[model samples]
Target: MTNLYRSRAMQDAEMSNSSFLPSLPSELLFHILSYLDIPDLLSISRTMHYLRTISLDPLLHTYRLQRASVILSRAIPSRPPLTELMARRVYITRTTLTALNLGRSLTMIRLKRQLERRPTVERLIELGVLPPECYLNQSNGISTTLGLYRRRKVVQKEKVRNFLAEWIGELSKRITRRMIDSSRSTRDASSL
Candidate 1:
C-alpha cells in the first residue's frame, strides 16, 4: 500500500512539472520552432522524442534554406558592381595578382637587406639614439633589445600606475573632507 501511494505521488509531481510546450498543438509548436536557428532546433531535438521528430523534419530545413536564398537574392543588388570592385583593386585578375605578389616579395627583400645593415641596439644606445631602458638581459646572460611592443607595454603600465595613484589620492581627500564635515555637524548639534 505504501509503494502504491508513493508511485501515485511521483506521477502527480511529474505531471505538474511537465512542459507546457508539449501540450500545445503540433502545428503551433512547429510554427514556433520554424523561427529558431539550426542550433536551437538541434538542442530542442535532444530534449524529447516528439520534438526530435519535428525538429529534424526535412520540410523545415528546406523552407529555411529557401527563405535564406530569397533574402540573399534581395541583398545581392545592394552590393557594388564587379567593375567597381576591380577598379578599387578589391578584385584582381590572376596575372595582376601574380605581379603584385612579385612586387611585394621584392619590397620585402629590400627591407630585409636594410634591416640587416641597421646599427645594433648597443651601438644605438652608445650613440644616444636609444635609451638605456631598451636593453634587456636574459637568464642566459645574453642581452637583447626591447622590441617596440614591450616598450609600449611598459609605458602603458606606467601610465596606468600613475593614473591609479592620482585617483586614489583624490578619493582619500574627498573621504577625509566628508568625515570632517560630518564630525563638525555632530558637534554643532550636541552644542544646541
Candidate 2:
C-alpha cells in the first residue's frame, strides 16, 4: 500500500513539471528561445531532451546571424572606416603603441633631469619663488613639498583675513559717524 501511494505522488510531480514548457506550442517556444544568446540556449538545451532539440536547431542560429548582419549593415554606413579611425588615433596599431611608449620614456627622462637640476626650497625662498614661511624650523625636520604648500596656504589665508578685518573696521567707523550726524540733526530740529 505504501509503495503504491509513493508512486502516485511521484507521477503527479512529474506531470506538473512536464506541463510547464512543453505545454507551449513549438513555434512560440522557438520565438522565445530566439531571444536567448548562445550560452543561455546551451544551458536550456542541457535541461531537457525536448529543449535540446529546439535550442540546437541550425535554423534558429541562421536567423540570429541574419538579424545581426542586417543590424551591422545598417550601422556601418554612419561610422568612419577602420583605417580612418586608426589614423585619428581612435585605434592603436603597433606603430602607434611604439611611438606612445617612446614619447613616455622621453618625457620621463626629461622630467628626471629637470628634477635633478631643480633648486632647493631654501634657494626658492631666497628667490621669492616660495614664501619665507616655508623655512624649516627646529621642531620640524626637513621641509617637504606638501609642508611648503601648506605654509603658503596659511600665509594667503592670513593676508585675506587681515584685509577683511581692515575693511570691516573702516565700514563700522563710517556707520557710526552717520548715526551720530543723524541724531544731532534731529535734536537741532526739535530745539528750533
Candidate 3:
C-alpha cells in the first residue's frame, strides 16, 4: 500500500509540473527580453545557444544599436559636432560587433582616449579608418611601416566617423525593415 501511494504521489507531481514546462511564445519572450537590462540580457544570452539566437533577433539588434547610440551621445564631446556615425566607427570594433554587451562602454573609453591626443595629422592617419588610398600619402611614413604592405587602411577619427556612419546606417536600415516585416507578419497571422 505504501509503494502504491508513493507511485500515485509521483504521478501527481508530474501532472502539476507538466504545464509549468510549456514553452513561452516568442512574442511574450521578446516582451520580457525588452524589459530586461542590457547586462542581464547579455548574461542570459551568453548562457546558452538557444537564448543567444533569440537575443540576436533582428529587432533586438536594432534595439542594441539604438542603445549604443544613446550611450555614445552621452559620452562624446559636445562642442566638436561628433556624429553618431563617428562614435560608432571608433567604438564598434570586431569583437564588439559580435557582442553588444561591452561594445558601447568600451567604445566610449577608446573614443575619449583618442580625442585627447596631440591633434596631429599623422596621429589622425594612424587612427583613421579610411582605406590606404584615402589618407595615406604615397610618400608618407605610414606607407612603409615595419615590413607592411604598401597600402593598408589607416583608422583616424574622421575616417572612423565615416565608416561608422556608413556601416551603422546600412545596418540600421536593414534592422528597421526587418522590424516592419516582422510586425506585418504578426498582424497577418493574428487576423487570419
Candidate 4:
C-alpha cells in the first residue's frame, strides 16, 4: 500500500510539471515572449533550453527592446545616480566585512594590518575617482612570501575578483550591443 501511494504521488507530480513551457508551440511561445521586457524575457528564457534559444532570436529582441525602453521611460527619473549605487555597495560590503571579523584568526589579523599599509588605489577605484585599469598596479606584495596555504588564499581573492570583473564587463558589453541594435530596429519600425 505504501509503494502504491508513492507511485500515485510521483505520477501526480510528473503530470503537474509536464504542463509548463514545454507545452507551448515555438511560434506561440515567441509571441508570448514578445510581451515581456528584456529582463523578464531573460529570466523566462532560462526556464527551458528551447525558450533560451527562441528568446535570443533577434526578432524577439526587437520587441523586447521596445518594451524595455518603454518600461524604463515610465520608471521614475529620480532614481539614484551611479555614485549612490557605488556608495550603497561599499556600505554593504563594509558592514558585512566587519561582521566577518568574528571568525578572524591571528594570520588574518596580520594580513589586515599588512593591507592597511598599502596604497589606497583600490579605495579610489571603488569610489570611481580612479579607473579599474589603474587598479591593476596595486597588488599587495606579501602574497609572494606567504606559505603555500596563505599564498593560495590571498591570491585566490584577487584572481576571483579579476575573473568576475572581466565577465561582468563582457555581460555589460553584450547588453549594450543588444540595446543599441534594438534601438535601431525601433527607429526602423517607427519610420515605417
Candidate 5:
C-alpha cells in the first residue's frame, strides 16, 4: 500500500521496516487479511502494529460475524491436522505437475509386469526378464566370472530393456489373471 492515506504511526512503521508487501492496495488489505488464518494474521501483526490493531479490532470481527451469520448456519471447525487425505487433496502447481509428468510408457508397464514377483535369478534369465550375465551362481551368491565389468560387456543395454519389457508384461498378465479370478469368485458367490 502507498503512503497517501497512511496514518503517522503507519508511515513510521513502514520507514522502520523494509518488509512492505508491494502492490497490494490498502483498500483490499483488511478484506484479504480477514480470510487468512489466525496464525497468519498474528504473523502479519508482527510486521506492523497498525495491522495488529486492525486485526484485533472487535468492530471488524463483529462485522464478520454479522455477515457470516447470514451465510453459514453451523460453526465449522478450522483446518484439520495434516493427513493422507489432506496430502492427496493438495492442488499441484502447473510447473510442478508438468515436471512430475512421465507420459504413459508401454515398455515400463510391460517391464513392471515381468518383474512383479522376485523370481529366482535363473528363472529371470530364462524368461529374459534379466540379462544372462546378471544371473549369479546361486550356490556361491556370486557371478560366474570374477570380472564384474566383463559381465557388463556381456549384458547390453538392449537386453536389459527387453528383459524389463518382458518382466512387466508378465507381471501385468499375472495381476489381470488374479483380478479375473477374484471377480469370478464374487460372481459365483452371488449366484449361489
Candidate 6:
C-alpha cells in the first residue's frame, strides 16, 4: 500500500499486460499488418509486443528498396525521360513536384482529390511542365487565344476563391465536431 510498493505493482501489471497476445501465427499477423495503413500499423505496433517484434519480410523489404532506388533516380530532374523510362517506373520528377508545390491553387486542387479526375487531358499539364499549346483552346484562332488567357485569368481567380471557401467551409464542420468531442473527453477525464 506504500507509494514505492504501488509503483512497483503498476510496473509488474504493465509487464504482464504485454504477455497475453492472441495465438495468431506470425505470418498471418504480418499479412494482416501489411493490409493496415501506416497509421493503424504504427498504433498497433506501439501497444502490441508481438507486432513490435515482427520484422519486415525480406522480399517486401528488398522490393521496397529496389522501388525506392528507381523512384529516386526517376525523380531526379536532370535524368532524361528515356533514361528514366528505362527504369521500373517513371515517378513524378523532382522538377515537376517543385513546380506543382510552387503553385498553391494547383496543390489545393490536388489535395482535395480533384486532380485525378480533372477535365484536363493530362494531370501533368497542371504541373506547368507541359507546352503552352496543350492548354490552348483549339477552337480559337491566335487573337482569340490571347483573349482566352485573359478571360481564363479572371475565371481562374474566381475558381481559386471558390475552392478556398469550399475547403474552409468543409473543414469547419469537422473542426467543430472535433472541438466538441475534445471538450467532452477533457470533461470526462477531469471527472475521473
- Local distance difference test values of all predictions, in order: 0.87, 0.88, 0.70, 0.78, 0.71, 0.69
Could you tell me the TM-score of candidate 4?
A: 0.30
TM-score of 6: 0.26
Error of 1 at 15 (Å): 18
User: lDDT: which candidate is best?
Assistant: 2
Q: Which of the predicted structures, 1 or 3, would earn the higher TM-score when compared with the native?
A: 1
Clash totals, every prediction:
0, 0, 8, 0, 13, 0
Best by TM-score: 2
**5 against 6, candidate with superior TM-score:** 5
User: How well is each residue in 1-192 modelled by candidate 2, as lDDT tens digits?
Assistant: 999999999988877785578878988988888888999999999998999999989998888888889989999899998899998889899988999999999999999999999999789988999776667765767655656688778999999999999999999999999999999999999999
User: Alpha carbon lDDT of residue 96, candidate 2?
Assistant: 86
lDDT of 1 by residue, 1-192 (tens): 999999999888877764766888988877888788999998999988889998988888887788889989999999899889999999998989999999999999999999999998779989998777676655557654568747788899999999999999999999999999999999999999
Flag the better candidate by lDDT, 1 or 5.
Answer: 1
Model 6: lowest-lDDT 10 consecutive positions? 55-64
Rank candidates by TM-score, best first.
2, 1, 4, 5, 6, 3
Residue 80 lDDT in candidate 3:
50
- Candidate 1 collision pairs: none
Please give the RMSD to the true structure for each candidate, in Å.
9.6, 13.2, 30.6, 32.3, 24.5, 23.9
By lDDT: ranked, best first: 2, 1, 4, 5, 3, 6
| Model 2 stretches astray by more than 4 angstroms | 1-70, 77-79, 132-170, 173-180, 183-187
Superposed model 3: Cα runs more than 4 Å off:
1-22, 61-192
Residue 50 accuracy (lDDT) in model 6: 63
Say what the RMSD of model 1 is. Answer: 9.6
Residue lDDT tens for model 4, 145-181: 2255466677989999999999999999999999999
Among all windows of 10 consecutive residues in model 5, the one with the lowest summed lDDT is 73-82
